[model samples]
Target: MIGVMREGGLLVLTLQRPDKANALSKAMLSDLLAALDDPPQVLILTGEGRVFSAGADLEEAKAGLATDPIWDQLSNRIATLPSLTIAALNGTLAGGAMGMALACDLRLAVPGAKFFYPVMRLGYLPQPADPARLVALIGPARAKLILMAGAKIEAEEALAWGLIDRIVVPEDLLTTARALGADVLAAIPGHASAIKRLIG
Candidate 1:
């Protein structure tokens, strides 16, 4: 499920489903897209509990391959949001969910959170955007370390590798993200999106 709220001009979306580690489901993905239909000046993505997202729901994935396109669409939607977007990674980021975080303009995580890619282990090839963004963010070599070596990157290593922007304490993740969002909103209107397009 998705929990949506607005604090000033910032929209906060929490991935709710702690029992399943906030695994992404098809319905949940649709909800995300719908929520973005009328986006605010800034959007902050987080999770209700200790897991940002467990990626695509495995049970649904096993049922059929139809979910692939939906996930791709989800990633694309996040990547192309008109406003500044932030991923407040409160916990581990795994599988396809990594693509979601990468799509954001900035990613901030708790010190204990981790970055993981299990594509090779699961015999699943990443969609184009996932690896492409990873390569753009880090580089071919470090991207391989994650896609090929199946590395589990901690906060410090991820920051060193340029995988994540910052690591805040667990209790401060949302507040920090919101404050950053406020900064983005305070900028000249449309400046954030323009900068994102110019740089990216």
Candidate 2:
């Protein structure tokens, strides 16, 4: 499930499935990809409760992986967003969830959130785009440790590795993300758009 709210020029998309750690379902992924097509000038993605995402719901993914194209399309939509996109990692991120976070242009993690890319352990391969993004954020060596060794890194380590842009207390997470979004919004619209295009 995804929750959407527009604040000024930004669109906030909150993953709403705490009991399941916001594991993405095929329909959910379809909706998310559609939302990305005409999103607000900035998009902020976060999750409910104490986890950004636990990745794809394994059972659900196993059932549809061969029949559905949701994952590929959703990944493409996220990677090609023309405007700003921020992943607010409110908590732990695992598996496919790591791919989702990496898709964003920026990331803000709560002080204790953990991150990992565990596709190797799952006997699956990440979408090709993800590896490049991971390498871009943290050099190839660190990316190899995460992908090959299936290592999990906490927020502080993620920040040091350049995987996350900032770390904030749990209670201050949303406030800090909003503040950063507002700061970006403060720029003239055309200039902000130009900068986003150049950086993206």
Candidate 3:
């Protein structure tokens, strides 16, 4: 499920499914789409507990891939969203979950959070849009290393590769993320939007 909260001009969306490692489900994807369509000035995405997301639920992915194009469309929307999108990676992120994090304009991960793209291991190809986004974040070489090897990179490695913007202690994750949001909110709304558009 999605939990939405407003802090000034920022909108914080938390993935609330620790029991399932915050795996993406059809309903959760739907909610995300709706949220992006009407996003706040700055959107902060994080998960409930120890895991940011474990990616698409295998069972759900199997069924949905046959009947829907939610994942593809969601990726497209996320890539083109006008707001300042930030992924507050609280814990481990894998597979399609990595796609979701990559979709964000900025990532602030907990110190020990692990990032992985494991689509190959699951007998599926990475999402078509992922290569470009991953390359944009960390360059072609590192992206290739991640996708080809399905390697899990911890926050420190991710920071060195420019895969994440910041890394903080787990206990400070939310506080740091909120402070970042506050910094964004401090700017005039119109200026913030203009800057986001210019940067994009």
- The number of the candidate with the highest TM-score is 1
For candidate 2, the 10 contiguous residues with the lowest summed lDDT are 64-73
**TM-score for each predicted model, relative to the true structure:** 0.94, 0.92, 0.91
Q: Candidates 1 and 2: which is better by lDDT? A: 1
Rank list by TM-score: 1, 2, 3
- Candidate 2 lDDT tens digits, 59-169: 886876523556666766776766677888889988776766788888999977998878778777876677888998899999998989999998889999999999988
How many residue-pair clashes does candidate 3 contain? 0
RMSD over all Cα atoms, model 3: 1.9
lDDT of 3 by residue, 1-200 (tens): 99988766778889999999998888898898887767677788899989999888768888865235677677777767666778889898888777777888889988788888876676777877778999998999899788988788988999999999998887887778777767667777567667777776
RMSD after Cα superposition, model 2? 1.8
lDDT scores in order: 0.85, 0.80, 0.81
How many residue-pair clashes does candidate 2 contain?
Answer: 0
Per-residue error (Å), model 3, residue 73: 2.5
